[model samples]
Target: MSTQINTIPASEAVRSAEERIASYDWQEFATELSGYGCAVLPKILTPEECKEIAALYPHEEHFRSHIHMARHGFGKGEYRYFKYPLPDLIGGLRTALYPHLADVANEWNARMGIDQRYPAEHKDFLKQCHDAGQTRPTPLLLQYVPGDFNCLHQDLYGDLAFPLQIAFLLSEPGEDFTGGEFVLTEQRPRMQSRAEVVPLRQGDAVAFAVHNRPVQGTKGNYRVNLRHGVSRVRSGQRHTVGIIFHDAK
Candidate 1:
């Protein structure tokens, strides 16, 4: 009698991830982003994977620097920027998500009267950032305890901003945290700032404007300034992984 083994090929795993990203209704996502300046994506990571990524937080070697938000007036929580040679899952996600986001970035840039256009691949964009003296990686993992929060701010690293960024909730909303809602504020010209509360779940991700986006106006297209933050966490702890395409200065 012969024994049998069952296993998935590495190529199959990559193909599945690629297909999952490609199969998303990006048209709908684009519309949502164009209308609201942010879009929430379906579950891209499994619950187990979310837990696994969150577990990496305690390991200091993986991170180059750990930031205390309160010390920097950023908020009450803390976050760590990953060092070079990111984890395989993170690097893969960064690469796989870039092309689709680059399309949207280019469209927004054109509409906003900006001349900069992103490259088709993430590595090419990183190279451009490096050539401009931005060598630090910007991808980070953020942790928040009860009463911890983040300030409404932009993730502008240098002159070559990608204009788009994504954050994934690694913990369950109500179970892991209560009042830590994702908040975004838009400053339209000649008007009061408007706040938007985005709802998310574990393994869910949101793509949002890093600084600003273009909105159609009577004359043509106008730029609206935007910022994002986390509301105070009422109870429990929260963890999120931020995927930023640009390198930092």
Candidate 2:
């Protein structure tokens, strides 16, 4: 018997995403990420694509697992991890984004005095994660109803973790939801934590540090830990797609 190969159809969403990424001002993005520990990319997804992803939240077949944040003390909402052979739209974003972020990750690792440089291709990095026995998918879609929220936390799944991750807002801030803003907090050495609210409109995405980032200090570059979450939603509903490059155990 001959084995048949199944190919995914081309997605306009993915094509558009590639074009957007290709046009990004990496120099500016790098400067922003270095200064603030995060960077924003607007309109990575179309409004229609956002709506489509949000609609997929209710379909269990598309996901490998569902997690209730409140059950784990993570927060009050829920999220579902995409199964292997992730939808083309999601997979394309991951593939298109990896190389650029890998460069930044390598740079940050060097500056922070850390070892382990990422590969130029995302597949090579995934092989590393799988070799370490982390075989589960980590990209997920999060849904929040009114009064729902996520607590500040890191997305580290296993020892092998990518330095950065991205989250795209699927719902309009005021029209589809309210008060559920993306939040990032940094813990500086010998100082109180500083919090930043990242204002995101529908289709806008934020690329942020997964754990710690290098910050220049009087002595030298120091590592500042980062945690991200969502504020409580006061009304309507909120949805988002989180793209994590590393797999889970």
Best by lDDT: 2
User: Hey, what RMSD does candidate 1 come out at?
Assistant: 4.6
| Candidate models: Cα lDDT each | 0.89, 0.91
lDDT: worst 10-residue window of model 2: 1-10
List candidate 1 segments past 4 Å from native: 1-16
lDDT of 1 by residue, 18-43 (tens): 87788789989999988998999979
Question: Which residue pairs in model 2 clash with each other?
Answer: none
- Candidate of highest TM-score: 2
The C-alpha stretches of model 2 lying farther than 4 A from their native spots are: 1-15
- lDDT by residue (1-249, candidate 2, tens digit) is 111111346476467557889988988998899899899998888897788788888888789999999899999999999999887788889988998899999999999999889999999999999999999999999999998999999999999999899999999988988999999999998999999999999999999999999998889899999999999999999999999999999
C-alpha RMSD values across all candidates: 4.6, 4.2
